[model samples]
Target: MIKSRRKLWLFVGLFFSVIILLTLLVAPSRNQLMSGSTFGVAPDGYAAWYEFMQERNAPIERWQKSFKTLQQNYSDNSITLLRVYGKSAQFAVSKTEREWVKKGNTLVNLAFQGRVTEAPFSTSHETDFGAVKIETTRRNTDSFKAILKDDFGAIIWQEKQSEGKIIYVTTPYLAANAYKLSPGNYDFLANLLESSGGNKILVDEYIHGYKDKETQEIEETSNVFAYLLNTTLLIILIQGLVIVLILIFVYNNTLEKKKI
Candidate 1:
């Protein structure tokens, strides 16, 4: 009986572990294949590109904490790659981050969210990055310089911000899983990063729900009620309460003597 119970518990443990693992493997949203995460394997993921860069000995690293921490710790000239869903106000850069960029950091903004855009004007150009030839579109205004363009507009563009600059790529999936099919993407991205003139490359994974232990602890401590209300923590708490209640009911029903 003891052996059988042990086996059952072990099976349960393994089953739950597998469940958690699978959950972590999936992207946060159906359309977003962990867009900015190097660990993503979906069509829109950067895993392929990240691996390619790593093999070539690129100076790259993943930033899995808040940008505030980044500004505080990194004083040197660095390049950050970021992906935003749209031109909405919610995706606007914060004042502190703008200041960080103004201090001479290059921020590569992958702007598209796997959707088509209606541009006011358009022009086509064949951009040769490395040995790869990409047909791009011109989609920027007088304020922004078009680097590469497609039918929808600029695939890559440049905007000056004091001593630093912000490079915008219309498609977030430029060097995604598709890179396996179109190997030119690897070369294109490699060339882009190399030309950025940064000491290091930082891919922002903090935007993808990844945080260091200290950051997590600090966030939890910042709001007691919010921490208690976390979905995962709430689920665990409820399950534990249910188990305790079941144990109490079983004890009362099976171990107590007859009252009358």
Candidate 2:
């Protein structure tokens, strides 16, 4: 009788475990959450633009790893896209990224703070695009700055280096899922990409907590267990304990009955 009860509990546990595993597998990955990648469908994500680029057969790739890793894999000719929000530290550019751009590649960085510590440009004007606002700047007098209509200065600006070019935008809403629908926002991005003159485009995903291949497996494993423990393990363990206690009580009562 005890053995049968144990088997039943084991089956129940396995069933729930399978269900949980399936749910997790079907759900969005942590890397996709709030990430501006093609896979991410979040409000702040750039899924729309990603798909649009795909449909147009534009050379766009989501770099779901460290900038160092991307630097190693992609050639210097690839155009790298990076968007920073809140604090610049959230998506800090390293020496690898700077060198990559310096080696004749284009780097488009859109920041809410309108600053890149490693490479700074001088501000000239500010502009509004419907609900979005942007501050524009240029590296030199010859550097490009997109003008909207005739008066408003569009947030887009460019700085030409000896080998490469650095384009900075004050706001990322131009490419975000919510604002990309606007014609002005869409046109601005189209023009920027055209002027960059690169066949390969790499959108940085490291800011969304994506790690390099070497550390990804370990971090994912640890993160999953930690998430389960924090969110569901307490209740699951309590329920399991109660089940075991009830089973013990029932088994004891059965033994007492048999003896009596």
Q: Pick the candidate with the highest TM-score.
A: 1
**Could you tell me which 10 consecutive residues in candidate 1 have the lowest summed lDDT?**
130-139
- Whole-model lDDT for model 1 versus the true structure? 0.64
- All candidates: TM-score: 0.64, 0.54
Residue 240 alpha-carbon offset, candidate 2, angstroms: 33
Q: How accurate is candidate 2 locally (lDDT)?
A: 0.59
Error (Å) of candidate 1 at residue 114 is 12
Q: Model 1: what TM-score?
A: 0.64
What is the C-alpha lDDT profile of model 1 across 1-260, one tens digit per residue? 46645655665565567546645653255345365467777765777888889999988877878887887888875655554332221255667777788878888876542234465322323447433333223344444676765456445788788978878776555677755666666777777777777888888877766678888998878676764465475456655665565556545644443442
Q: What tens-digit string does per-residue lDDT give for candidate 2 at 78-183? A: 5656553422233455667667778888877766534333222332222332333222332222226543311323355666666887776655555667655554
User: What is the number of backbone collisions in each predicted candidate, taken in the order shown?
Assistant: 4, 0
